[model samples]
Target: MVKAGRVLALLLLLLSFGVTAPTATADAAPVLSSVWTGTWETAPSGTAPALPGAAIRNVVHTSVGGTAVRIRLSNRFGTVPLTLGAVTVALRRAGGGPAAVAGSMRVATFSGAESVNLPPGWDVLTDPVSLAVPAAADLLVTVFTPADSGPATYHRTALQTSYVAAQGEQRAADEDGTAYSAKIHYWYYVTGVDVRGTAAGSVVAFGDSLTDGNGSTTDANHRWPDRLAERLQGRRLGVLNAGLAGNRLLRDGVGPSALARLDADALSRAGVRALIVLEGINDIKGSPEASDPVAFVEAYREIVTRAHALGIRVVGATLTPYGGYSAFTAAREAVRQKVNALIRTGGVFDAVVDLDAVVRDPASPERIRPDYDPGDHLHFNDAGMRVLADAVEPAVVG
Candidate 1:
């Protein structure tokens, strides 16, 4: 190497002649950008009774592995300021439930503090915690509050089971989880879990109960989105499900309308590369029905336009068959057929995943395949979810 004094003298000579030196780091390691992908998420569908001094153990499955992770808590439906006494994240034991894997727990802080206070209708993300998160694994995010902060923002239809601690208890940091005995299907406070150093972005599965795994086996993680995540094992793309059971595209009930909450649930999510939409069946079947197929098609186009504006590719999924359901009417079927045709041919999305074509019975055309139907006729079984996942071509996704 050249001496330091000689290098300085050379630089000064070059500067005197108005010559600039070349970058010395041309062969150095490339600088990497900060990449944080949303590995798992659930939209807030409604509010539930607050737990007060209790802790909620929200069990969430990851779509991608990472060297570090962060948690998001929500008070979107709260009328009062929500105060969290403590928060912790841990890997779950193999058998599952409240118990955590030994030495895998990490405390979550807000601005380096153990506690955080969230105002009404707002959400907050915890500071990053160094942890090794495995892909396609379970994580237990425990939240404890010492005071009654009014109605809690919650996702009402998590098909997987979560746990709730006894009242007057603050066991957010508990690893054994004996304090959490009461099993609950609701996910409280915790809205999302994000993993870093995995994929640079994620694909959002956006829709209603079909995407939410409404008819699949409980605690099986067999939702279509979950199955899709399994296929993305090393594709460098995370998968996040933004489904709401009974959610509609034109109206609000189980959650805000798909259009109204699009940004909150899917568009604004961390590092979204593509979106898969499987909504509109509810609008066709619900009371005060949206009879106009034009309305539904317009909504799909709007979603595509909005996603495209942010450089995100949109995938449209045709609504599945519901022939044997109680709300199936010939007129509603006609409306569904019209809307689906438009989605398939109207150029509403960058690509299409024809879920209805795969899950519908070839014999009846309007009914779900016998093996895939879980007796409800509208929703899919584990096998059907697998088919849906298989139908999503990796090449087509952004």
Candidate 2:
């Protein structure tokens, strides 16, 4: 009996240690990962035509919570090596002005040359330093380049807002020479901005130009995802914009196709909790022969399934109104409506963001409200972009 009692005590001791030991390490909160958000606009450093429409700028009001950040620059569609003369990141005060010099500025550069060679399709350039950011703080990331090739392959679809100025100007410089003094909706090659938090987990926004904020104002970080990030300020969610201009759901085009880019864009990110997918417009518009409603639905399902397998929640965003676009036709409109129906009623997604319902005109369900359309009848202006952000449901993120 004595021996048996000792054995029982030993077994109990082992069980208690096993149960408590593992949890001690497991109980530590996750290390939150940050996402970089910005746009790829045009410039004239070489024989390349000057990109005049909307130059990128630094946005001070839009950034909220973050302790550390990393900025990504792209050489992704350059024929020649792009030269960045100097790059600086600084803090901004309220009303879109520069803040008092409370923190030191950081410099960003590539390894090989003062200029970085960006091959045909993609380039990921990181800052030379990491920044210590604070909650509800605003900072500006500025890049200076001596020249660029013609028609710099800009990221037309930038979900996060950014600011830009001429080659040798500061964010707080006088408006006469600043490229961003006059707001326009164009971006240059800086693709993303990542913020670090004390916790673990992040979210990636994956889609095309609309998700990229094609028609929104430049230097004004007013993209919907930007607003979403602002709303999620204190929550343990990090937002990354993986949107690409002319990106498709299944086919490869401007940036990488959705499926092809998935690993690099979302899965490979440091810590990902959920993926918000707002794609398929380009696929529907570009591929007339490829328009099998069933196939489109299946592809979407596959994307969600793959994400789920990786333990990531998949959030589906209904494609916004595009009935007035030059490419819009009765057939395409039918497809759009059909796909949206599936997304809304389809249980495949873990959650849904009905962008269509939010921006569509009540009188004309097929088109966007004039107030919301950024003149292209497809994209949103700054105000319209704000509505898009408001349309997102916070619960869907979880």
Candidate 3:
């Protein structure tokens, strides 16, 4: 009787453990809802507008369906007061068709001043506007400028390929005379956009220029990260691109350094799950101070540790090849190789994306394939960007 009682107790305990274990697994970690990052520009390349000055304008097209949309604008590089005037968000038809005026537009205006001044080195998020967006719908976000504020940073997004109307070009506004036309290049400093969905979490892509789509075709909306978002379609995973051009893992260059910006860019974001970190090339080649392989490894370790403490999963990407650029040198190449070796072998990262192995030319081994290398060999062309995006394992990301 004693033996039978003990057996029955053990069976009950095992059943309880099974039920509780699966519950813990189901709530493993928070998932992302949506994510995006880019820059806003005052004018298209080649044309210079007046300063103090000219009103810089661009548009954001979104197909993300939600009731509330949030816009994140940056003055991270601005030295003077930056005022944003006549901010409006609207929906457009496929292939840059006419805007959905009447009931489809929402104007985001400042309560007091026509424009909001952004102090240098700081960024601000607008209040969430209540708007209904449809799936795969294009949104046109227009900014009317009265003078040149500063360097306008923008993130370029358009269905298919399109162009941003240059300055002085007359664009028709709605009955309110607020919206205007401008050239588009998908690369903008505006940074992030989060769509409030029925889900509970979001994702952040922590990367550098490649992830920022340095050489991808402008207004085409073909950045690898963008492609990844399209793949998620309706999973309700929020994806935010925290990529900056000329950014590094250990030091600052084009924008705030990765480690320095992590808090505001990733940790501070609501309901963040996994972090896709595809940086370090700039650290290997563009470090203004000095390049030490050992020091680079230590910095990476610290980044991983900090992220893990926040319950975020870190996925490390091996630095891509840069063998033929003007900046390339045997010494720099050796440093890059060492860093890649550490990223692959080191157990710090939760997972690894072997971008180097995926993009490197078998013939040269140290150089990117001609087909994939944009003229400079340092950045990937659109096709190369696709390859890099495909290299990412969806299972690990989810």
- Give the backbone clash total of model 1: 0
Best of the two (1, 3) by lDDT: 1
Q: Report the C-alpha displacement of residue 154, candidate 2, in angstroms.
A: 4.3
Model 1, span 231-339: residue lDDT tens: 8876978899999998999889687899888887888777788999999999999988999989998898888888887788999999899999999998999999999
TM-score of each: 0.90, 0.69, 0.75
Candidate 1 residue-wise lDDT at 76: 80
Report lDDT per candidate. Answer: 0.85, 0.60, 0.59
The local distance difference test score of model 2 is 0.60
Off by over 4 Å in 3: 1-57, 61-64, 97-102, 109-117, 134-137, 145-189, 287-290
For model 2, residues 288-322, the per-residue Cα lDDT tens digits are 43566777788889888878877888989998878
Model 2 clashes, total count? 32
lDDT of 3 by residue, 183-208 (tens): 34443334444455554355567777
Predict model 3's lDDT versus the native: 0.59
**Residue pairs whose backbone atoms clash in candidate 1:** none
Best by TM-score: 1
Clashes of each: 0, 32, 43
